[model samples]
Target: MSQGPAPRVLSDEALSELLGGQQFGTLATNKRSGHPHLTTMLYKWDPEARVLRFSTTADRIKVKQLRRDPRAALHVSGGDVWSFAVAEGEAEVSEVTTVPGDSTGQELLAMVRGSVDPADEDAFLQQLVDERRVVIRLKVQRLYGTALDVNG
Candidate 1:
């Protein structure tokens, strides 16, 4: 009998690439009941800053959970079934955007617009205010992942 190949620990660069290359991931926040609250989120990865940014409504449960416990983990798929990555960090939620064109609104605009500007900048800002949007900044402290060697 022969033993099967074990999963290889992915390098830091590989992990960062996987996280940065993808826009969606599962965000796990610590609940008051000592369990994890998971939510599928669309996020922006800043490799240089080692931070993940998410734009969400201020009234969301995830926000409330994070407010109680700042610890969070983001799990991102590595473009294959055998590959994946998890980023653990402390999340800081911004104050809900109240006035249009405020700092929070501007940051939300950048996160949503990326390199392009929205068709109606004022309308976009107004919408951010109306939606009670907040930015969750996850400052990644540790990155770890593994890839299984299925091809022998």
Candidate 2:
């Protein structure tokens, strides 16, 4: 199998930076009625595979819509720094990875540091898991954005 695209659209380093920037984007999915549903999310980037992964509830409206139609788009932009990344492609939702409440708590705290307290980690995780359902991995089939045509 091919290791990657003919020309790496986004370098591994750049992808990692994108993730570290904590730059969230509005993920838009088509509802059954053919309207859009948007939501904010934090993503994990896998450099070697060049994939972006994020989690959401299985019963979420967006997730349900995605099941009906896999097409979706991600709108990412920055203000402090003038930048943007817009990607449109298909999405896949994995079976919920049953992580322990404490582990999920730690991951959440890491994502939003001081906002959460160490003491309430377990309780918060349990609450979140009880509410949300699945983990989503978005494989970007086409990525287009500012600062992307450096070589061209």
Indicate which candidate wins on lDDT.
1
**Worst 10-residue lDDT window, candidate 2:** 143-152
Worst 10 residues of 1 by lDDT: 110-119
The true-versus-predicted C-alpha distance at residue 25 of model 1, in Å, is 0.5
- Where does model 2 exceed 4 Å of error? 1-20, 79-82, 97-129, 147-152
Candidate 1 C-alpha lDDT tens digits along 14-122: 9999998999999999888999999999999999999999999999999999998899999998867888999999999999999999999999888867554656889
Look at candidate 2 and give me any clashing residue pairs. Answer: 57-133
Clashes of 1: 0
Residues 1-152, candidate 2, lDDT per residue (tens digit)? 64532332455355445544655778889987788888987665554565666667777887878788888887666333335566677888765435545444444445455666878766666766676546566777766544322322
True-structure lDDT of candidate 1: 0.93
RMSD, each candidate, Å?
A: 1.6, 8.3
